[model samples]
Target: MANSLLKHPDFMRLWSAQIGSAFGSRITRTVLPIIAILLIDADPNEIAILSALSFAPGLIVAFFAGGFIDRNQKRPLLIVTDLVRAALIFSIPLAAFFGSITMMQLYIVAALVGAATALFQIADNAYLPRLVEKDQLVEANSKLESTDAVAEAAGPGIAGLLVSLVTAPVAMMVDGFTYLWSALMLTRIKKQEPEKQARDENDNLLSDAIAGLKACTNHPVVGPILAAETLLAFFGGTYLTLYMIVGLRTIGLDPFTLGVIISLGGVGGFLGAMAAAPMAQKLGLRTTLLITLALGQLSNFFIPLAAAMPEFGAAFLALQQIAGDIFMTIFVIQALSLRQRVMDENLLARANATFQLTTGIAVTISALLAGPLTIIFGIAPVLWGAAIGSMLALPIMWLAKEEKAA
Candidate 1:
């Protein structure tokens, strides 16, 4: 089965691009914050805004990007977005070298990258179904997910080393090269299918977007999935911010130790993605999702407790990170596979857009509140609070009958 999956040419091409992009993204995800904090000397509030700006464009561009992607060729969209992001990110190092880099420039670059990323995401999800057979979907997604897991595990450590060696801004240049590499790989792939002509007949982008929104809102499975994902994002976002703060400030772990802890989760994610197919076959999708969801929520409690207890905090944090990553990998692979299987190809991009938009909104809100909430309630309280919020999603999952279809 693995051999067959690995042999599929289109999947291989897509997987390569995804791996390259994932590596690049991890560099930014780690180095960008470090730059803001260490280089720019940003306050907590400014850091929060930086995070929010990075995600905010998805909320604004997702629906429109979906509509646009649905009407166009996926390959070109992916290539163009990757190229644009590459150019934008490459400018960071250039501006820094010239001693002209500003916080405003950073914000603008992040936001613009986010916008281009929105289009790429929509196009990528929509393009997947066309690239592989339906039965191979899970396997293909697993391979991609596994690559992401590997990237997550390796990218930050590399970024940390690179930043230590050559500063944060210079480290970003590595990601710029990765994006260019991804774009080149994408361009080399031959997509025989022509672009969809559906939007050419329609003159009104607004009307089309609204209709796409309605479709997602009306879909029984997709709507609930979006709701659950939103809840997860809300809690997960806050938990992430708190996790970093707690680890660095409260627990007093050094950067290297923190990186290792984060990397451990990526190892778990890789294992989880590798195990997803068997687990799904054993537990069924519905059972697996519910179990993982519960486990995911339970996992967050460890973070706060880890923060409060110094002696065993590192171990607890590592365990929590692993559990969360495993749950997330399983949840994403199954949920996305189910979505792709059920939704019409024509509407897939819009459905994915809706999910992305919900996540973006939830993350934005969480980023905004996380700083203030941490200050008011402390990082431990914020962590526990987000854990509680995650549990709220279980009822939504139950009420929506997510188990029935599976």
Candidate 2:
């Protein structure tokens, strides 16, 4: 149904940039925690605050970001953000070289990078539709998601290895350079955009944003599924907030072993990404969506349950990660594909921003709540709470009705 992207030069340029950026993002995500726990000796709450700070910018910027992105050329924004992120991340290693690395500096970097990431995401999503034809959106999105899966598969392990060979802060330099790589790739893409609509000077502040929110919420399939994703984001944020502590402190996984266990998720994700198109064809997209959600949600139960049974050890935890990663891979690709297929290109950025707004808030709330809740009820109880929240939202998906991969 879609044109092959094999010969599409612009799409290839974008894809190559994505591959670099995805891996860089993952490496930074992996190494930052190591730097926090090992270098800065961050407590559970400190880590929580760090995460909240990184994700918080989305809450602040996502609301109006779509309107901003939709009104501009995407590639320039992408290039600028990539360059800024590269500079911000490089500060970690430079500070370490001067023996001045501090938690505050890391916080600044996270916040700045998060802001850049928010802008880049909105621009990137909006740009994709313009680069490819309507029917090719799936193939494009699928390839992109697959790149993310590949990044996930290799990122942590690579980070772990890099951290072991070099210092954790030095490992961050790898990510910093990759962003520059992404920017270079972006410069080579030659696509041009259609003119932006002329905005009235009297345009309401949130007219476009409100319209996007209304459209997403009113769509039966998009509405319910997006809600599920928001809830899952909450659960995911909480799970991650506790994952470092749980794995490093309680279950006792060294960084390398932890990285390996996490990498298994990437392996699962790779397979899941490979399966999306074929599975969508064999079993309707709706069925595939529902099934993957069920599996992903079910995987959440295992993490908290593993805490109760230490005898099962890291193997159970690995199982949890593998399930969560694979199902989430499929879910993400399909969801993006569905949204791109159904929504008008003009409104895509706003709709994405609207989705980002709720999900970003969910993550922020989870990060803010996770530390204190763990202090009170402990990690296991809070994790179980996350699982329950995800489960409660699952029934909402029943309201979503559609057929086919699109």
Across residues 28-82, which tens digit of lDDT does each residue of candidate 2 receive? 7778878989988899888877876777887667787787777777888899999
- Tens-digit lDDT string for candidate 1 (87-141): 9998889988888877898888888987887778778888888888777778878
Instruction: Show where candidate 2 strays beyond 4 Å.
Output: 1-3, 32-49, 91-104, 166-170, 202-205, 372-378
Poorly placed runs, candidate 1 (over 4 Å): 33-48, 97-99, 166-170, 200-205, 374-378, 399-406
Instruction: Output the worst ten-in-a-row residue range by lDDT, candidate 1.
Output: 397-406
As a TM-score, model 1 comes out at: 0.90
Give the candidate number with the greatest TM-score. 1
What Cα-based lDDT does every candidate model obtain?
Answer: 0.81, 0.83
